[model samples]
Target: MVKQEKVKVKPLPATIIPPTSWVKYFKEWHGLKFPVITCRPLGRLGNLMGEYATMYSLKRHYNVSVVMNSEFKSRIKHIFLNTSLPDIPASAGPFQLQDWTPVQNIGSLYNYAPIELAAAGLLGPKKFIMKEYAFEMQMFHQFREELKKEFTFAPNYTNKVNEFLSNIMKNRSSQLPDPVFVGFHIRRTDYKKFVKNKFGGHLPGTSYFTRALTHYRTKYPDAAVFVVASDDLQYARAELQQYQDVYFSQGFSAGQDMALLSSCNHSIITLGSFGFWTAYLAGGEVVYADVTTKHDYRFSRKSFEKFGLDYFIPLSVD
Candidate 1:
């Protein structure tokens, strides 16, 4: 006799609880079955990374099986070597199938689960949909090494990144010894308004980059090259072209750009999740505009705390 895969079907409504209702996300689970979780990805690459990492942490820490929907894989899997998590199809829109409970996350939302809850069961129903916008960076550091291995750039991306890095290093003058690369992620576009409204952040100007670059130069001297990647490349070049030893990496997918940046010595990030992940992967001293959100918001603090105690962005510099 063949075994049957049990699946439950229902239409779960979009979940958006006001601050008054956060208590429910942490509420007790009374379901008889152990929960099986799968996160539905939302937003672009940066947001997708955060969502996957959150679920990835749960899968590792809680010792439960976590799955990914096919859309998540189509958007995320190819960039990394090990998107090894199992996947299911979610082609039918807004329809929840079999034991799956919907999890709605506002920006940077995290559904907290304790070890006690993990014991014998994983907090809730037969299945969970860790719906998007889940930026749980706090515990992400705990699984950092495994995450790095899992998110390692695919072979093609690695090769392109290697060539880019090699060319940048080889073409530099002998006058600049002991070459060091400083990856600069200058975030533009919608951020000017988005940061202001959401986190009370201001978009940095050229002086911000100059100040950050100066910090690197003082430490690495002429050996430092500011390799910039930005949405507005033309504007970036216009703003900082006067600076010596500056290079701009253009015409690469975000994955390839990230691979190149991560291979570098250090990072300078303005603001935005893209910048955050690039710096996270680079794993070195980080310099940011002092304009980065000072007092973190309710759920977004994890994004800030992952940088740890070491950063070189003083108010006076900005």
Candidate 2:
């Protein structure tokens, strides 16, 4: 008798808690199962670059399902802050397919491949191409160039950031200012081991934000609010007091800040991924710290300038 071929049931991409744009592809690739895994609290960059991205790619291409035991989630939450990158072990390879409990199919949502590319890292030179994917790849190259621009963090976060924009638009009730607006970012969590593992490391803090806000007030008396987002709430709040019109958003679980930041009109970014994502979301001009080699904070005018982003004013640390 001939050996039988194994049945290939399409597996769905895993559902990450605090869901991100990556999910866009899962719904688009209709043949795959729906959310084979549930990764709650993928807030840390370590989780993003390592487990989160890794698992996502695996599911996207290979149809694997990973389940972090509930017990582990409970244990890790208590020790999360003090935990280092090495503390979290990589998942066992080629997740076991037998673990999946079968489920019925649900209806499909509309599919848009351009939306998927943003989260999939497909826009990078070495990755997927819109020319090849065609309908799915619309805006792939243009958007990639747009992403390299200062305001192009990922270009996808803005798709749903209306809440933040509405708040700013509502706040802009008075007569409009001459030049548009400015945003400020104070990234306090840059150095922690979690951040360095993914985005290389943190950048130094220059006092550029305070100076710009002061100047905007002097030059454009009617300038609107300077929206400021920070990793360390207490640290940013104290330093920002000099600007009476500044608005601060409550801190969000790690990767979620990009969604919130993208809604704003403009921004000032520090030298970190969090700030970069926010600036990308805003898609407007920005001001950055003049990083010194000795300090090694990584925002460069060259980086943002490629995307039509520029620093309106430089800040002074002293």
Candidate 3:
């Protein structure tokens, strides 16, 4: 037998940007001298949406580059596969930090001033860095079509998503004619703390899920298969097992899980931007938890409105 050669997996480069290269690149791209807008994204996958939205909005007017926090680089690559967004290379020379602008509050209140304001600031000769969550969904609304092109899943994850859907469909074919895949995202783990702190009233209970499931069953009685995606798979499996034709996604990365969730025909989402993004990408019927009572800092009604999903059913836990 011939000896098998092992393929080596290359580690991600320490820095994507070369020192002082950003300043030079910016001038060339615009065909004139211009300030560099470097955006530093913070937090996990959900919060990154806000940062990306801000970047997307800024890109329309100014030269923008993302300086991703070291921890989230892998996650970013997984979620935004084969996409090209101008990112500040790790080796790029130091960026001139600017005053932190509080855009989340302004964007939350349905104001467009922040976008224009940031653009106006870039008109000056000085390079600047934006330090904010910039979680405004509206910032991305105008360019959503363009954004969708940039936020596609990588091929490996895409294949897994397709496989999951195929398996669910095949399993359900015997029980019902034309089974409808309904994705449910039960965000627990850290969200439990949010509940304990009275951040969002109370965590959505089993009753809320059951009620939402029943509504779908009634509407699509032909057949419905619930594909559950959650941080706590064991708890999710136990809690949702009462319903027939229920299934749980096997161990998968968060990016893979979101791809599966987005592939469904319908979505049952709880709190968090991750769920919101899955439902948004699914572009199907959605039933979300009504956590309006909990004044969670990240939860924003305006964000949902910006998605143009007026028909989403909000199931109240209280």
Candidate 4:
């Protein structure tokens, strides 16, 4: 792991609001010349990607320096190759949380990207702050290919997953020289409630996996190899024991697990930030569980416009 101690930003005093949206009279204090936008990310890997990607997207738009919060700087820096940024000290942050601008998180709302507002806000050079949850938005699209370059997993992780895949392939009687590896992410645990309340009561179960596996089988026909990774390994093993060409990835850390799944030709997600990213990095036909109810905003087609065709498929959870 790389040491995350260095910082390039020198914190400065907050400058008065400039130009429009109601401007206050203020002289230009030349002390704050280059504006620094801080990327304040919360939650786990999924949320961090959104936060950082938003900031990265902002840097592309605003053409300024981007910084990361010290807390998450170390946790996520190792996952990707290009997450090089200065860490912000607490002193640089605003006295009150509300002091920071409220930027709308319409990354999911693909049809309209606020051209005027970067992930932080569109304004002249002055230190600005940002806040959480953005892994699945269209606003992050422009830098996505670049984001992929930035997010490419460490070589150690890739090697580990590759070795595991090789071993699994060797055991199979049929040798597909160019097998289509299909990754499956079974997200259980907290999702039972999160989905019930936020999206709908429906959740992916054994049937959901079987259906997804069946669909992939019909599509790839001869060369579909299923590689299942999950928070609940025992559940996945038990449920999928009857199927052939299916293998479980074990003895790896969470980061390694993500590396294994994202290396596949496609993905099957059961709804969560982790699953969302795995499918995204894999960049193929992504089949996600429809956790949203009929009118739920989370399941809108317009929201997922950035994705390719046949990305979502609703299956019987029971």
Candidate 5:
């Protein structure tokens, strides 16, 4: 057996609104500590960023241990770290939560969906006296810089995640891949109004995607464009039929999806959680559609900016 050197992580002040099993998973799988930070669901973005940034910023910070808080004993924990800025700052506008209602002024519906306005708003009166928007932006600016240092240097993705990646590369997993190997995501969970009216769309990024695939085909005619999507694969497969190796994955466990995503050499992401997480784990070059829809530009710009423009290929204008 290969002797593994244990990592030391600093005792985190508190973990933010992370997924329930996040701390426990970190402890058992990675041996990291993540004390829960009990902030409002849509509040404390600054504190959240600070906590992860500080903990991840240093190597050998401290050895961490956390108790599992999940239903399943063998359940694996998945940790998602996000610190991105929206194109049009929602918190900067006059739409404060106290003033806006959820009925019609759809812009302020849910903070994190279109933008993390609710979380930004949670900065509070006394602390956010001058300008909450500015504070949040600066906070992200600092946080991004800190994360860049950590993400680039250390293994931002967990060890179990890496093992999962290895398994997928060897093609020994439940989630089977189709020929082309295309990665895509459906962000229909939100956009309730759009869902009702059937007007909401995939950020108008489909066109950008077709063009990217066309370019990829020109270079590597034999390489299959494997796609990982949150929605049904039939639609995308039917549309993108011309590719030589086009494939999509059936809906599977988060760990399964994450593993499959990391094994891909190239991918495309939508403007939603599923896609965001997949692309991040892919650790490969990605292509993003330049979204023109309301509030979508936030994710389009943020994902590219947050992860690194180098990893993304934006949809073309014109």
Candidate 6:
């Protein structure tokens, strides 16, 4: 019998397929599954910004559902009526998926390892629960314009706020030129004790306000009106009485105060996220703060840097 010669087959040339579309790439990048981020944020109005902003940032990569209790809804609805975020009932059960992950802080969510793993479709979680205040300003800085659209006030609130501002302006002397409206937020009451414990003597003194007031007056020599929003109205009233054209916003609710603050052309803020957000959303020409006060771990210099707020004029309590 004749032996047949062995045949050898050569491999075909490597195919040069084009890259996939962005939509397809995005889907596959996240492991062929879209993520859902559920959050139950707790805090006062200012603290809520950290929560809302974090969710807004996450919206870029996942579906965000905020578990807003009735109290939370009542507090924020007027100011942020068009939140555009989907809501889950406060009583909803835990996300029962085996792949659920809990990110308790902003640092963990933005850490290099997690981000890299997520991009490579290796991160196992399909749903993430954010239980802490992601107060790091960087979380939402990239989506500021988007956040502005999402957090627009309801029309009724906006109209009322506008009328209130108009009345304030109208009350000024007609002989004087239209004065610049400067919002001042003195975060006292609990904040005083907080500052004493956290910042020692770095708490902003009465001199800080007077100095800031004088600075603005010099800068806008013709006219300047300062609207004071303080938890301690009497303190603001007493401290600011020597200055002219200062109005204390004593009777308004917290939401109303925030709206009024955001309407100002400039601001003097204190050492809290609440004050930080008011100045930020207002898009004021100038924002003054006492940066000498040290921040707790939850916030830091990087937080201010992330929001481009390092430029805030630093007032000295001394």
Residue-by-residue lDDT tens digits, candidate 2, 81-190: 32211211234333233443322112321132332433343332121211111111112213333333312223334433455656666766556753355567777754
Residue runs of model 5 more than 4 Å from their true location after superposition: 1-36, 39-182, 186-202, 306-308
Q: Report the number of clashing residue pairs per model.
A: 3, 10, 10, 1, 25, 0
Error of 2 at 134 (Å): 26
- lDDT-based ranking: 1, 4, 3, 6, 2, 5
Candidate 2 ranges with C-alpha deviation above 4 Å? 1-142, 145-161, 164-181, 190-206, 218-220, 295-298, 301-318
Best candidate (score: TM-score):
1
For residue 130, give model 6's deviation from the true position in Å.
0.9
TM-score of decoy 6: 0.75
lDDT of 5 at 288: 60
Model 5: what TM-score?
0.46
Give lDDT: candidate 5, residue 57: 23
Q: Which candidate leads the pack in lDDT?
A: 1
In model 6, the Cα lDDT at residue 171 comes to 81
- Say which prediction, candidate 2 or candidate 4, comes out ahead on lDDT: 4
In order, candidate lDDTs are 0.65, 0.43, 0.63, 0.64, 0.38, 0.60
lDDT per residue for candidate 3 within 1-318, as digits (tens), equals: 111222333322222233333332334223323444445666667667666666666665344433343333454876676445554544544333343233323534334344444454423444444444555454465566676676788888889988887876776646468888888988888877856675545568787778778878887886877888988898898898876668888857788888888888899888877787777677678887766553434443433543444646666554
Query: Of the candidates numbered 2 and 3, which has the greater lDDT value?
Result: 3
Q: All predictions: root-mean-square deviation over Cα?
A: 12.2, 17.2, 12.8, 10.3, 15.1, 16.1
The positional error of residue 204 in candidate 5, measured at the CA in angstroms, is 3.2
Model 3 segments more than 4 A misplaced: 1-33, 61-74, 89-116, 195-200, 294-303
Candidate 4: lDDT over CA atoms? 0.64
TM-score of each: 0.77, 0.45, 0.76, 0.75, 0.46, 0.75
> Mind giving the per-residue lDDT tens digits that candidate 1 earns over 217-245?
88886788888888778888898888768
